[model samples]
Target: MKHLRFLNKYFYKYKWWIIPGVFFVIISNIFGVIPAQVIGHAFNLITENIQIYGLFSGFERREIIYDIFSYSLLYFGALVLVLYLLRGLFLFFMRQTIILMSRHIEYDMKNEIYAHYQELSLGFYRRNNTGDLMNRATEDVNRVRMYVGPAIMYAINTGVLFLLVIYAMFSVNTTLAIFCLLPLPVLVVIIYFVNTMINQKSEQIQEQLSKLSSFVQERFSGIRVIKSYVREPYTKKVFAEESEGYKQSAMSLVKVQALFYPTMLLLVGLSTILTIYVGGKQVINGSITPGNIAEFIVYVNQLTFPVSMLGWVTTLIQRASASQKRINEFLQLKPEIISGKQEKRAINGNIKFENVSFTYPDTGIKALRNVNFEIKQGQFVAIIGRTGSGKSTLANLIMRMYDVEAGRIIIDNTYLKELNLQDYRNQIGFVPQEVFLFSDTIKNNIAFGLDTVNDNEVEAAAKNAAVYNNIIDFELKFETMLGERGITLSGGQKQRVSIARALIKEPKILIFDDCLSAVDTRTEEEILNNLGRIMNNKTSILIAHRISTIKNADKILVLDDGQIIEEGTHNELLQKGGAYAEMYQNQLLEEESQSV
Candidate 1:
């Protein structure tokens, strides 16, 4: 009933079509009931030995036969014509209604799911499979559309037909009608049990299918790495196992379906046989006329179709229920980060972190502990740390990807939480460690967020990032199409493009998280020098492992185990012989030895 309610609103919008379609359906069914009357009346006319009237009522016996033939042809022809025309009309509207309903539901569902994704914290995406989200957005929504479109209409039609046949049978002969329906109660019970089993099995099948989709997506995306590591056989073996599980689950569902259809057929057939035998006896005993018996038999057969369709409807409902449950569960997930109910705040990039502590949602392990930092307006600050030292976590906090457990982060003298997230983030730009680009032209990627920007500004940003020459080398230049994830570009080119994209935003606060790692030392130096000039008065945060990357910064912070151990200029840190001093000495020795 809850799922049905979900479809009601959309159904109402197209009720005009449905109402007419249903009226046509009823007209077709009424016409279908006529053939039985014709059969019974012809029998009576023959048995009674009556002088059947001709077309004019005063005609020869040959004319009488011809009249009967013509009347019979007209009766049958009218039934066929009405049924064909009305059914075709109804079918057209029904298809249109279904398409309209499915498209509306799909559009709404996709937007709702995407909105939820946008609200959810980064932790949710990190723990969940990308393919699973894709399936929920695409496959699950489609399944729900199937239910809304075809399943609902079929359910309605089946119910109408079942009741029509039952009423017709009762009107003809009550005793025989009751006897014909004796198997119905038992059949209902059996169908209920089968439907329950089907729902359970179908849910499992869909879950396994989701897993299979995820496996395929993961493998395909990482195929390069798998081949590079020479793990083809191992990956194949894992995928084979997942595929086999999906196959086995599907077969299990098939087995249940096979049993259900046969049971339905047997029940319907038995009811039909009962109607024939009992009604035949009634006719011979004069309890009812031959015509009545003939009509009863026709009605009984009519009932068979709806009964048989019950199995298919049950299967559809089961699949729909499974899909609905998955979609509901996804919608119910609460994002780890919550948006505040306040007006948008104007930012000038004065950031201060006071006693911040953080933990990942999945593991609840502390990623940062009592970390404190501050950057005055328009300052160039660098963060240096070993791997897993919570350097990225700090950046994530500043970006508000995850909320801190205990602390306050202030931006431009306002609490971070008391600002509209989208508007606040619009003032900041981040270039992550691993750059990702959409499969679009280079120009669009650079000006992604903005609605409109001149080509001159885009060119300027590209030149500042030192990738203008590379872009011009290609035939399409800025209009060149990059393959998926920027696969057409080398690693260094992709990184520089990402940098240009972030820089073009002209954000007040710019973050480069290991963005220079992929380029050669000379290239890295050139980019750093260019960035220094571009960021003269703009607030910037540089995260890197190399001392040279942070050498020109106003201040550098050395982090170890989530806490800042040292903070000073590069020369000041080297003179102290601390953690920063030790790292600098090692890199200096390595560089000198390589040069020799």
Candidate 2:
């Protein structure tokens, strides 16, 4: 009951529907027991008027007995018929209203989970896998729905029917009724223990499912790498092992159910035996009529189904309990990144990193050490750093992907933390080295950042990125749908499209974090040449390894081992004979060698 406390709000939300549904459940079950009582009375009526159906038509017959038997049989038939009608009607409403409400609640829960996921910081995504999250949203949500819908409905049905049948049994013969109900407490104890085991097993099974889902998702996403390495046999073996673990968990649950249901059935069967023996003796001893024995038997038989159903309903409840616990654990997590309450104001893109030092979560290594730099509005600054020298980390900080651990990042003379996060991010455009595109039309992908797509703006952005000519060469042009992550396009084409996506935003500050690495030097130069006009009067930060890409920028900062080693123009760095000069020489030599 405590585990189900999370669903209190949903129950309150749908109480109008749920209350009527529960009412129907009670009505249906109440009607359900009427048939058994009617059958018993019909038997008693026949017994009372045994001579009414005499063999000879001319035999002396009691007219009143004949009329009473005929009328009683007709009335009993009509009573049973009407009860069936009411039972069916209420059952329909119970299932239609309650089960559908559960589905609606499921929809709301999934949406809520997804909405919360969007609000969580990037660090959370780094710690969790997509498949595990998917399992919680889909399979776990479905299990919760079972608890809210069928398990609740059936539990109520069992309770109502049990009470009605018990009263009916006592009315037939109190002693027999008491004796027949003696085994129910033992059945309850058995159910409680079995339910505990089932819950533990269900948790294990759900965990295994998450692992298997993660494995399949990761493998499929990297199938090309696996195929290129010819590792299918090894991957298949790993999948088979995971599948076996899942099967073992499932079998454990099945084994518990296999034992539990039969035990319940056996107890119910014993209760029926008790009723037959006790009632038969009472009849034989003249303490009750033969009709009383028949009626008691019918009442005890009606008790069998609800008693046996206890095990199944218990399984639903425990499974839902286990799933709800998992979901609540995720829901309880509060995001580390909190947005500011300030309203968005105009930004001039005067960015400054003042003595910034940062370290990643769960790692002792400082990714950036007292990094100090500033770019005035409309300044073109290039950061050239070796691999692992914290260039991307700087861009990520500026994007507000992670906060600096020890220092302040100021934008437009205000601390970055004080600005509204969404509004701040909306003013900046970013293109990362690894590009990802949705499976949508080329036009839609380019215009994805905009609230509304303007065809003219999209085409201009594509042209500025130098991918427009190649796009128009296709038969469908901008309307063509891309494959997953734009796999159908070449590497350079994909990067250009990503650039176009950023350019369409017309952001005040544009950070290109080695996004042109895949393009050839010629196309890279052409795209940069076109960007000169678009970048006018706007601040731009170019992070790259190629000296040619940033040689013409207003300023260049060379980084090494998380510290800036050189800061000057291209010719100034060459004259100083520092790290940038050496890198330029090596790159020139590599190019000269490649030509030969």
Candidate 3:
């Protein structure tokens, strides 16, 4: 319930729905109980007339008495029909209010959770699985909706019906009422303990269901791999095992649920039996009329459905509590990354790292150690390094994905953290080693960096990336849609499309983190030639392993083991004849031998 308390604000926010809904609940119950009273009076009318007609059997007008009794009964029947109709009408209104409010709250809850997910840092995503996040937003929110809607509605209905029915019974005959209600307290105690079991089992079911969903989601995401590796049998066996576990958990909950209705009806039946027995004695002793017995029975039966809903409503609420607790786990978390409040400013891409050091938070690997570098605006800088030489780490720091631990980064003389985060990222175009594209049209994918774009601009960027010819060869051209992660395109095509996405922004700084590896050397040279023409006035940083790619860079930095070992123009490093020169001579030999 402490976790369930998170929804209290929603209850307050939608109070209008609740207040009107409560009014209708009370009104509907009032109308519902009135019919029982009418039936009682109608019974008494029939009995009294039966006595009259019998006494007047010697009279010549007994047929007239029969007609009078028939008319009176017909009127009472119509009145009872109208009463039930009114009750049903109010019930509809009750649903319109309370149930409708629950849907609104569901919409709000999902958006709130999704927005929170967006604000969370990369570490948060790394720590939690995608399926778990999705389940909390969707399935868990649905459970909470049940508590706010149907469970609350039924609980209110039961309470109001009990009050009205009990009052009517006691008013008629206190002794019969006392005896009739004796079975109810025992019913409560039994349901209380049963509900405890229900709560535990329901929580277990929810947990297992999350796990099952995660398993299925992960399998589908890697379906291609599973099929390619011919491991379908293995995956199928694991899926079957997970499904069996889920079924067992569900059946356990169902078994507990199965106990609810029968036990509920049985106790209600006992109350009915008590009513007839005690009520018959009262009638024989001249304490009440036979009509009073009829009325009491009607009242008890009126309470029957509401009382039966006890277990179901309790089960819904219990499950909802379990779900809300899971949701609160994420809702209560403060995002590790908070955006700066600084206003947006123009970026000139003069980046300097002073005494910078960083370690991966999750892996605990020191990626950069006391690194210092400076890149002036509009300079083409290239970083060449081995596989683990911290090339990608430098690019990530420039993008401010993670804050520096030891030293500060300055962008155009402003502390990197002091600049607005969103604004800062918007001015830079980054193409990572692993390119990711959305499942959308080529035009949209190329123009994704901008809020609004035209076909001409998309084409221009595509041409700049040397992918325009490939795109135009398609029958649908720019309108061609892609599959998941742009799977419809070849590896080289995907890389070019990603490059077009970054290029369309006309950013102040462009960082290519070995994105040209997928393309042939000729295509790479063509794309780099376009970059030289288009990005002549903007800072460009290209990270690659090929010495040929960085031969013409204004400044080349060679990194090894998280530290820069050499920095100079290609010709200057050649003069030094150290690590850079040795690598250059090796690649030259490899290329010359391949030509032979």
Cα displacement (angstroms), candidate 1, residue 415, comes to: 0.9
Each model's lDDT comes to 0.82, 0.88, 0.91
Residue-pair clashes, model 2: 0
Ranking by TM-score: 2, 3, 1
Tens digit of per-residue lDDT, candidate 2, span 224-332: 8999999999999999999999999999999999998888788888887887798789878877776766766766677777777777888888888888888888888
lDDT of 2 at 280: 83
Each prediction's TM-score versus the true structure:
0.94, 0.96, 0.95
Q: Candidate 3 on 1-596: residue-level lDDT in tens?
A: 77788999999999999999999999999999999889989988988999999988878799899999999999999999999999999999999999999999999999999999988877788878888889889999999999999999999999999999989899988999998899889988988898788888888888888888888888987888999999999989998998899899889988888978888888889888998899999999999888988998898888789888888898899899999989988988987656678899889989999999988898898999889989999999999988998999999889988888799999999888888889989999999899899989999999988999988999999999999999999999999999988889999999999999999999899999999989999999999999998898799999998899999999998988888899989999999999999999999999999999
Q: Where does candidate 3 have its weakest 10-residue lDDT segment?
A: 332-341
Give the CA lDDT, 0 to 100, for residue 547 in model 1.
88
In the range 125-244, model 1's lDDT, one tens digit per residue, is 888898898888888788787777677767777777777777777887898989888888988898889988988887888898889889989988888899899999998899899989
Error of 2 at 430 (Å): 1.1
